[model samples]
Target chain A: MSLTRRELLKFSSIAAVALAATGCSLTEPTSENPESMGSVGMGTPAELAETDAPKVVIVGGGWSGLSIAKYTKKFAPNAEVILVEQRTEFMSCPLSNLWVVDAIKLEFLMHDYLQASRENNYTFFNATVVGVDKTQKIISTSDGDIAYDYLVLAPGIDYDYSEWTSDPVLERRLRTEYPAGFKPGSEHISLRNKVLDFEEGNFILTVPSGNYRCLPAPYERACLIADYFKKEGIEGKVILLDENPNITIKQDGFRSAFEKLYGDYIEYLPGSKIINFDLDNKKVETEFGEIIEFADAAFYPKVRGSKLLEIAGVAKDSRFNKMEADINVFTYEVNGYPEIYCTGDARPMGFSKSGNTANTEGVYVAKQIAAKINGKKEMPAWESPLTICFSAVAMEPILAISINAGYAYDEKQKAFGFTDVYANEKWDGRVGKNNGKGLMEWAKGMYRDMFNA
Target chain B: MKRRSFLKVVSATGMMIAINPSMINQVLRADDGRLYKSYARVQLLNAEGTPMTEQMLETSENYVFNYPYEGTTTLLINLPNESAKDVSLKDEFGEAYLWKGGVGSRRTIVAYSGICPHQLTHINKKDSFITYRKKGERFEGHVVCDGHTSVYDPEHGCKVMKGKAPQPMASIVLEVGDDNTLYAVGVLGPDKYHEFFKSFRRELKEQFGSKRNAKKEVVSTAVAMRLSAYTQEVIQL
Candidate 1:
């Protein structure tokens, strides 16, 4: 845990004055007033535990960052690793859909960052990164500046509601009121409340174009909400608005659930893009000239890498997403900056942006960073990140569909594509129950892998 | 790996005996488990309290036994053919070690830590994602963990044949006594016992009643039984 901003500012200023009085270069940070460092935020050194070991600073405490921190420390024990995250606690995004519908408790989605740090022997600094000094190898946070020998930026994803609406007021209203709930924390809570307190009329959800975070999540959310409505005997329906022509993933299973299970509760619309939104009237105009009305909606827009990549000067437009990290595909290092690495949802790769993908990819990234730390000349060979995702189609018994796949670089396409794809699209009878059990087990295993159980 | 009718599935969980931690701590402590160290030469007993010998083994079944530590479950398998010899393997941390194949008259018996070395997916009391697949199965003649689909070949010292397992499963060095009693002596390759204990502390508390009870080192003998009998739900993928 970190001190409040006010306390830190005062403490840092006092320390700076004390250092100035002594007139010796005692610390790595300059003896300047932290308030004077405008864009830099905090000029004072972070009040971290003193260590002479090589510092490996990681930004974000999500699945990717957490895994990298733990595995990097495990593989290279001598390195002093620190994970800088803005959030106080970690909330899992994978099984959070279950949490949204009251199928699973909030405790299941939440994890203590301090516990993860304590068990893994890394420092979890609760601070938001304000800026980075590439030349000095220092990342300035709201708390203070932390210098590092190696830096890993794993800021996940940011919602791009630009294409939906250019009006800032409309966008702001969308963000605060009817949020996409892709990111963890408040958005998820808001979404959960919106579903639980919902009484009647159509509850609209959208499937955004491009390789969005958790390809099947929107479909799963629709199904779960429809199931909730069906179970509660609520006079409502879920109008699923998909930009794509058909179901992007686990089509058979989701279609079956929509038809066989929640026929009256769900209205799945394919290739229906919201060209115009009438939030005032609770209606939206689709691209194919279909005007849809709703009582409530969660507009999940197109996803792009976090704006942190642009701030770090490592951003570029990828084939799939805009403003993603421009890095060597094999190694996660920034184009020319070997010491700086960018991973997780910010990467330009076409890998599925799910918790499982991030965790597996994080391990591979950790290996590359560890190799450099261990004084290895050559980085390890490129490894494929396994994407194992499970989507719930029902709630009472929790019938689900699953996908287990790995990626391989395709020379012809000059890009990466899913290989060894295994899909279990059966969500009926005992097989569905088994898949449901597998889903829970997979999640627990993933949680244990990322955190220290 | 389909669910079979478990007719003779025995429950011998009453045989759990806690040993002195201080005494076993000396032998259990290893840097990377690179050094082959011996423990209690416990006899492998089947469901009927009869010592398991060569004739009583099934080639297609997955057997379970706790070793070194109570929470650290291990897999005992009798392959259909003679196991390969002197298979070279590497640990997750890039340390290389040799696995000196299987034991018994037909050289078909092999044992490995049930816990996956990659993510520590193990044979848990509730459900086991890791188990042996029978002949003509998806991962035929291999121990497949459905969690991440990590397939380990018992014929080649449980070497990872597919999926994302960082290292091969740690081999349980077994020996046949003069009286033909099978005993697990030591472990070869890198073991995740320490990490396993550290990772599953919460589950350990629930499963064994306390962390200390779960961490209790195996001293005299460990009950060997079928995987289906050990875990309540043995999931198949």
Candidate 2:
């Protein structure tokens, strides 16, 4: 008898659990809900015995991954969606930045991704994906090798010290001792303590070589730290060591406010590339002819996709090791291989590697796969993503919002051009007395949209 | 400096009209040619001159007006002695700058602008107006900026006392209406009083002095910037 997607999900869940006890795999056929999943609860599990739905495998229960999983279930409730995440609780990276600053505690950042999976009637695997076989359309995790027709990857970023060429070992030593505090938890708290007791000296901040997760974050950190110092009446200068020639986005406005008000307190040293550092001396040697001693320094190392991307042969580019896909259209399939799909930060796109972008890509790719499986004539095209960033200078906060949409083909230039709609502005703290308030709201809303929507 | 100006004639006539020291009444009878007419009748109540009395106050559902002095023209309202509760009053600048939230030997609703003279931040009564009385120093009423912790002296025409706000707080005239209600009659300072004066309003761009590059505004910026820098430094420890 033909089983509907909902019935299949229910039966497969029982079968999945039973198989788990016996350590076996019950390879089942694909299933999906026939009615559009715009609204929730169209038919009961008993009536869902005759629908065909696609099977989706989502790796990472992060903002992007969980968001895709939840959206896929919402758009096609009968579809068999399985989320493979290593963490039982998903922590937000957006707000995690504050954890390093002691602005907020960790418990406030943690959310139960496992509970969400169960409520959505989707399968959850609390295991890490070691490999993805593109040819076989199967993912080999610590738990078991799971097969899937459609795959969405939002497995975030990782740091690399190799780019610091002149002094990789020294930089690594600093990290070993000081910790990056990029991810939440112990590192965040340790760093937060270091900032609280900071006294008279030169505090240095280094920007990463490539596209980091959040662009305006380091600058925001500087501003917050500067505000902290002014309040304590400790005399010092904050020296920003930029690997790049100039600051991007709110850097100009930040410089204006910092210089006009706190210029005496801050010494901006441009063209300072972290070629190497002497951890023993606590001195950093930059590309420029300057060796500086720092009381405190935060090095935002270069970032790239997860190592799993390289192992799966899903990543086409070696430099960043990201999947090369036609971003104009949502197609994650390898050349001539239509069954397998890739999405999220792993996929190479024109937009910056951001959590928001990854989440958008995940939903877009998931819908495409669902459409192919359901034989829907039209599918939503890959639209450009929107970005909202909040930066706080001193006590006042500013916000910038930008959206990218539309595409263009340059025939003469033999290149593709895109038309996009974008909007951005610095937060006028006058409107809202509190800094970072809107940012907190956006972070919460974005997280909910990704996982709960 | 018109010799026929109402203020000039009033000074020459030697009339001892006791105006609220904190208030700037621009209703000079000498300036009849001044393009604007008074919108409402104001009662001047000087807390410094006359002790607050219950008989001098008019209580309404929305507001309570204090008439300290009996005059054909009233422009100031004094607070009642027994009334110890916080009373908030919005200045002519549409900024609510005063709230009597602190307990003191005596409390008065001195006429002060809600706008921070240093920057345009609204002077919030809750955060502003708390001055720790120094030894041998008078406890000048303070006004705090909600945007920044800039404080101003309410008694000294809203001068910056201990904060980043550079300009002195402007004052407005308080008047009792026909219904015994208190209203903001006019503002102090030639620039402030002329801000809404029809023809003069068109000329006035912003009340904050543009040419005066005073160092008074640095108190807030300096403190905040120093604290932020210190936090960045200590966190490394």
Candidate 3:
């Protein structure tokens, strides 16, 4: 499709949102045509067997996109579902921290969208989404055009390196020089190589502000990297520069591990919010007035919804799309586009953009999409998603934490109070292995539900 | 019987995929070109080229395979000594991988990882040989992953017997330096072992054919009986 740069950015942003809607995973592969192109729909063939299948177009086959596709296939199996993703396979950002430590390979962390969505029985377009016209309910991709009854936006976050650091080359150098390895691919490999090469040097980790993917990830990264250094007889310290006062999730557990086992090797500089960086000097000047220099640095920059969400007029003050504060869930049909839904990291929910959270949101949204298509009146009672994260302490004694948040009306105070559900514990090593197995099964089951089921 | 028959059955009783030593040199070549080449010239580093720990050397002496969950490679370990006993590790499905005796003269027991070639399921040990089945057959007497029927040759470098799996069981190199102490030289794989022979294909076709022809019938007849025994233990959660 011939799309203008502006339209491309807009569509790319929406595609990002659609991708995140599926939790950064592509839809199941369609066996007939290897290039299973298009977006997620409300139903496949079987679910829409009785009712006329709604033509749902999902852009970007990442987590959020795949989730919407999965649920849609389940409840409305007869719906004409279309998923469009640029990548052939989906690589997870959840366990990516292990890739930085050479514990897991990138291939091991990736899933074939085509193979997974084979039985999904949808038109799969292995092409980049370019533009979407909500008025016409039509989305255009690199390959062709698709019409949709319901549009799901979840393209996932883009590295607005421009927002944090202006220089893409410098950003490239930061990864090349110090090995930040924030995003994926070579960056991860470089970071791993840098870590293995380092016998002893100051390793600095900085977490940028605003909501980002896997809030606890940077801390976990720091812990794993630190463990690697310690094992290698490296005489160094991992200095953490928090853009905020403290991390949002399991901050205490990370701090305890740092202090207890790696007391001599680790240091945390709270409120060391990095304003910008001078890549040449290898220095990041923070808002808290600390100019820190390091032998190596890993930066986790701030996150925002895909640019399409903003162009669609769904994004709020910051780049993130605003969620309805009443429920704190990021599921809404835009005023102009009533048939479309936005969720996940792309949706402006004041929550950590995590795999578990996004997965739960995807399931919830799927159920919602099913209800809407079935002509149900009342929207299902929206329950807050439970958040669970596994953080390995040197690939041993993996820690697990479950988190949930909800709204409750305080009649006595005539106001609203938050019912926060949070639990943290050290998962037994064997249990953690079992959890890994369980998660693998869940992925397989989820893949089946998206395609076969 | 011909000399080949005595050699055939006994040899068939234990299978090992011969690996080339140069593959290890290549991976280490990236780490430190000089050190790897130096070791390659000496050919002292065994299969994996990963430095062996004292614990691994000791374990290799008694058992051919030790499931060390803590190590980088979790499957088979090869011992350098020839006197070590042949043993098998089985999974819940009764699939097995053999941990054949010592690879060298150091009396060092080497254990290779028993993870299947397809999915990374740990190979189970049962009786004298670790055997894995697919659908119902003994998976042609090869190590088959329960998740997907990817096969492996444990005696060798855990080479893939069949299916889409490319990599082999990384051989844990067993070495005894001048100090008379056993050490894991390195891990062995196609990338590490393909240099020694003009790619033998590990004779997987013969191995698979022999096992399949010898026993064509399904063995899950016993597996169904085990499932019923477990049903009584469940209280309906």
Q: What is the DockQ of each candidate?
A: 0.48, 0.01, 0.02
Residues B1-237, candidate 1: write the lDDT tens digits. Answer: 222122111113322121221232134423323424445666788888788786677887889998867888889999998999777676665555566678889889999998887778889788888888887878889989887778989999888898878888888888877888887776666678888888778889998998889877686677789999999988876
Candidate 1, position B227, lDDT: 92
TM-score of candidate 1 to 2 decimals:
0.89
lDDT of 2 by residue, B122-212 (tens): 2111222222122233322244442323455443444455533324555444443445433444443322222222212211223323212
Candidate 2 ranges with C-alpha deviation above 4 Å? A1-53, A166-174, A234-236, A318-330, A334-336, A395-435, A451-453, B1-237
Candidate achieving the largest DockQ: 1
What local lDDT does model 2 show for residue A448? 42
Per TM-score, the best of the predicted structures is 1
Of the candidates shown, which would achieve the greatest lDDT relative to the real structure? 1
| Candidate 3 deviant stretches above 4 angstroms | A1-53, A160-182, A318-331, A377-379, A396-422, A427-453, B1-237
Q: If scored against the real structure, what TM-score would every candidate get?
A: 0.89, 0.54, 0.55
The 10 consecutive residues of candidate 3 chain B with the worst lDDT sum are: B1-10
Interface RMSD of 1: 1.2
Name the 10 consecutive residues with the lowest summed lDDT in model 1 chain B: B2-11
- The deviation in Å at residue A244 for candidate 1 is 0.9
Docking class of 3: incorrect
Evaluation by lDDT, superior candidate among 1 and 2: 1
Evaluated on CA atoms against the true complex, candidate 2 attains a DockQ of: 0.01
